[model samples]
Target: GVASVAISKCCQVSDVFTELCIASRTKSKCDALAAKLAPTTRTKITTAQVDADDVQQLCDLINSYKPDLVMNIALPY
Candidate 1:
């Protein structure tokens, strides 16, 4: 995924992102992406399985993470 690769590149610049969570509809894909990005990133990588189509689950995820900022990479088309 472009976002994962791009994020890995961003990490190369500096330790910008301290806690980076990659949540996707496909949990394994998220894990795989993190694994690929791990070696090149200083950011702490975490993975979560999320179905964006689920409103309740999405709310739960946000609360669980309690992120200072949220970047919605999966933009609605």
Candidate 2:
């Protein structure tokens, strides 16, 4: 929880993060976080429903986003 918030906040302040995708298996949580940060940050925030354990899903997201960086902060349930 702390890590996700902290990272998102960091991204908010830095020019390096022009865009951020806050993905989680629980997409509502990601949406909440994105909503909280969206008003204050210039970073373009988006949310996606994703299962961290699924290789194909992860790969698909990576391919689609083609991000310069990726942070997997998901915890095992």
Candidate 3:
């Protein structure tokens, strides 16, 4: 999973941040990845369910997390 790879990279270079919020349309998938990352990474990892197409949901998620940066990875379909 790309998410796994991305989270692994974050663990590899975890000096810049103390936490990561993993959100996706599929909450189970996000949670699974977050679980995988949590034990291995020094940085704290959290999971949430979010549908990026929903503006309010996305905004609320961003507001809730207040992340310093967000990486939106999507396929060009």
lDDT of each: 0.80, 0.82, 0.83
Ranking by TM-score: 3, 2, 1
* Reference-based TM-score, model 3: 0.88
lDDT of 2 at 22: 80
7-68: candidate 1 lDDT, tens digit per residue: 67656764567778888888998898888878876778888998888999889999999987
Error of 1 at 16 (Å): 2.2
Number of the top candidate by TM-score? 3
The C-alpha RMSD in Å for every predicted model, in order, reads: 1.8, 1.8, 1.3
Please provide TM-scores, in order, for all candidate models, with all chains considered together.
0.82, 0.86, 0.88
Worst-scoring 10-residue span by lDDT in model 1: 6-15
The residue ranges of model 2 lying beyond 4 angstroms of the native Cα positions read: none
TM-score pick, better of 1 and 3: 3
Instruction: Report the C-alpha lDDT of model 2 over 1-77, residue by residue, as the tens digit.
Output: 87577767666675878888888888998888888887788888888988888999999999998889898765556
Span of ten consecutive residues with least summed lDDT in model 2: 3-12
